[model samples]
Each structure stands twice: as structure tokens, then as C-alpha cells.
Target: MKLLTLRLTQNMHARSSLLALALCVGATSGEGALGIFEDHADIGATRRAGSAEYHAATQAYTVSGGGENMWFTNDAFHFVWKRVSGDVTLAADISFPTAGGNAHRKACLLIRQSLEPESAYADAVVHGDGLTSLQYRETRNARTYEIQSGVSGPKRLRIEKRGKYVSMSIAAEGEPLH
Candidate 1:
């Protein structure tokens, strides 16, 4: 919850492009699929083909296809908080309970911390297909980069930013990617 401005560094220019892409993807979301921290989200209706069960104890929500076929199509979900700046680090544990049947299902972590409710500061996502990548957008233009990892399941993703330089490291909970 600490707010601090990032100082310009050597790699600021390169990382800026990555940051921009995150904003772009974060801005566009499927209708009713996007949920904020305080919002009451219906996981089944949002994805249009699944049922979501919220676990109050863990503060995490799980979505499952209640015997219905489903895929995450433009379904965007994010946690909102005060704008964060400086050398910030964000991490999350996510999984696709139904990933065994659908490879297109996905979950993502958003960072940067912005006041603009319409967009995120920066964000990255991992698809159920075992492709880990980062996506960012400044305004209308957006970009995606594939991370080098073919393993998937339960994952812990971390994004760290120092000045304009940013780096992402990911690993499965029980095994190493290498």
C-alpha cells in the first residue's frame, strides 16, 4: 500500500514498452467478466460457461464447469488497490481447476497500481496451454511476450520493477521449471 515514484534508470526505455502493453490488455475486458476486489462476482455467469465457488477463508475464488463446456473468452478479472509505484513486487498463486479439459483457460496477475479504474498499471497472464507470458498496453496498442516455460498447473508468478526495468520469474509450487 506504499506509494512511491520510480526513478528513471538505464533500462527505463525498454521496460516502458512492456508496461504499456499491460495497460492495454488490462483496459479491455469482457462484459460482466471483469471483477474488482470489492465487487460481487458471479464466476459462472461472468465466464458464461462455468461455476465459481468463493472460499472466504482463503480469499480466493474457484471456478468450475458444472458439467457444462466452457472456455475463458475475453474474461478478465483483476484485484484493485491503491496505486503502487517505485520498485514494487507483485505475486500470486493461481490455478485452472478445469485445465485438464480446456487448454485455452487462463489466469493472470496485474501490477503497477493505478488510479484509473478503467485500466491496470501493468499485468501478466499464463494460459492453461502451459504458455507463460507478459502483456502490456499504453493506450490503444498492446503487446504480448511469451516466457520460456512449458510447465503448467499451480503457479507462483512474480513481477519486480526497479525504476523502469522490470523482470518476471515464475515456478510451479511442487516442481522446478528447469
Candidate 2:
């Protein structure tokens, strides 16, 4: 199956589009939502907003800590929404430009976000170790579930939540996870 890969250049507009695509399709995240990046935690850098750089050719994003840099924290980034309802699904094409030093950078679907923008729920992340998994954060404690996945170009990450059950699925293309 051909991956739904999007080459992300250093285009702010493209990044914004990618952000929208990552958030709009799914229902609002609920507390105990169980996803990834439950808040506005920075993926690569904690101090610089939008510090990560995107490469169009490889469709990957890169970031380094500088000025208050820290490992990926839920407080530094999050998908903000006024309210979330119904079933939710997100498809992302992500890549990592570099990795190391507790970078823990990732691209995935964030959900159950509060309107505040500083808090929400997240799932589906491609870690710095080139591993993909699902995780959630509550009061500085993050719980991650290691799942077998190939982290590379044009990777597709998905999340679905219905009632009290939430599930994560990843694929390049060829039939959505059921």
C-alpha cells in the first residue's frame, strides 16, 4: 500500500495544515481519554514554540534542545479544542530528522484535549528510538504501551475512540484498521 506521505518543508502554512489534519478528524478527547501528548508539551524542544523543523523531501521533523530544552513533556505541547464529541480518527505522515539525548520527539494524534490548550490526551507516537507506541499523561506521569511498528517516511498513524474504549493503529495505506 502506498503511504499517504506529505513532504513538509519549512513552510509554516504546511505545518499548520498538518496540525489541522492531525486534530480535526477526531472527536474531542475526554479525560482518561488515553492517547498521546495530553497537553501542549513540546515534542523536541520545550522552550521554543514551533522549534521543530520539517523537511519536505523526507516528510520528517527535527528539533534540538536549547534555551530551556527538555525531553518531550506534556506541558509543553497539546492539541487544544473547545469541546470534543463523537468518534475521532487522525492520519499523520511523520518522519524524524534526528534522534538522541532524551529527545523523545514524536509525531502522533493527540486527543481528549481541553479548551485550555495546555491540557488534553494523546496517543500514537513515533519515539526517538524509532519505535511507535501509545501513551497518556496524568499529572506528570506518562504511561506508554510499546507496540510493534515500522517508523519511517510517510508513516500513517491513527486513533479511534468510542464510548470508553480507545484504540491506536498505524499503517502506510491499504485499508484502514477495523
TM-score against native, each model: 0.49, 0.51
Q: Give a tens-digit lDDT track for model 2, residues 31-145.
A: 3221222322233223334433334455343432222211234333322222346666655565443334233444555554543323335566655455666655432434333
Residue by residue across 1-178, what tens digits does model 1's lDDT show?
Answer: 2111111111111111011111112222222222212232222223232333344434454443221111222212322232344565655555554424345444545553343333323455565566676544433222333444455443766556677765666776644322
In model 2, the runs with Cα more than 4 Å from the true position are 1-22, 26-45, 51-74, 78-83, 98-103, 115-120, 138-154, 172-178
Clashing pairs in 1: 20-136, 20-137, 20-138, 21-136, 21-137, 22-135, 22-136, 22-137, 23-137, 24-137
Give candidate 1 regions above 4 Å deviation: 1-56, 59-82, 112-121, 138-140, 145-154, 174-178
